[model samples]
Target: MRIYGPSGTTIGSPAGNTKRSGSTGFSLPDDAASTQATRPAAAPKAAANIDALLALQGIEEDPVERRKRSVQRGKGALDVLDDLKLGLLAGNFDASTVGRLREAAANLKASSGDPGLDAVLSEIELRVEVELAKAGQF
Candidate 1:
């Protein structure tokens, strides 16, 4: 009677020599881009939106990370301010634009450690809040 166990050259193995077969390469196409292009673009955009939403919540507050995020928020708020101001000048302060400005203000609450920049950010945030409130009353 023979008991079957590991056949490879491992500890307590019965045989020291093992026979292995050569692995054949898969018959995949060389042009990966062609295959990838067939996928629906909407799937990637939805995944990107989810990733962005996650990134926005509970962001790391390490000094370097905070500075990077703070700069992003400041720049984003400024861009929103520019757009909002331009739209206000053009008499286009619809609810959508007001909502976007409010969102920017909310995200721009972090201080960047610079007195001058902090003051400017505070002013921009205050203006956005005031503008949104005034728009809401109308």
Candidate 2:
């Protein structure tokens, strides 16, 4: 089998040895200098604006990470509920556990951007509210 290359070309020819067929030169139009002269200089950015922009960038949270955090919070709330149950069964219930449950309920209010997880979290929040209401601590 034979492999063919362009006419007037050889397999081992150096790129520098290639023949030029056009001017290959670049030139700007006559109005290029006038356009550049007419353009306005960029204004300097304020320090306060730069600081605010940086702070806003830091404030943006990743969706997946936010979802994971929500799930963990839901699990934490569930664990607290289980503890509450065990405490009741053992006659060792305390006020701190209810306070933690209230905090968890508040944390569960933030959306996790996942439909299923948000639904589950809402259910957990509902249960927490119910427990808090029953204890008259809500």
Candidate 3:
């Protein structure tokens, strides 16, 4: 008869008691039993305290300063778009198309203020589509 493991993989044969074999490929030495006898017993789990958890809720502070610091930090959307334009022109496009895309992006930046970067990106995407269409890439 076959004995299967938890995942249904067959482990070994289960025949007569004298012929029964476990999964261990090698025989254990007689000294192995003595080595296991001296191991320390595992410690019991600690009980949870509801009062300690409730006390932690009162210690937490508000985050007004962190919000102000984040608002002041880092480049805004226009800076990122300018960088992307530079990368695109440097990678594949000719000078005339890159120039027109850059001019449209600048116009978009001036008109839309902070939110205009999205429009600028959209303009660049349109320019790429037009170029790709010219080359029959799309």
Q: What is the C-alpha lDDT of each candidate?
A: 0.69, 0.82, 0.46
Q: Once model 3 is optimally superposed onto the true structure by TM-score, how far is the C-alpha of residue 113 displaced, in angstroms?
A: 11
Model 2 poorest ten-residue lDDT run? 1-10
Q: What is the lDDT of candidate 3?
A: 0.46
TM-score of each: 0.48, 0.57, 0.22
State the lDDT of candidate 1 residue by residue for 38-122, as single tens digits.
6555643345577777676646545566667777887887787788778779987667777788789788787776677678778
* Per-residue alpha-carbon lDDT of candidate 2 for residues 105-125, written as tens digits (9 for 90 to 100): 998998998999999999999
TM-score-best of 2 and 3? 2
Query: Order of all candidates by lDDT, from best down to worst?
Result: 2, 1, 3
TM-score of 3: 0.22
lDDT of 3 by residue, 30-128 (tens): 555567866688898764887777567534523444333222222232344455467667886455544544454343332222334445445655554
Error of 3 at 48 (Å): 32
TM-score of 2: 0.57
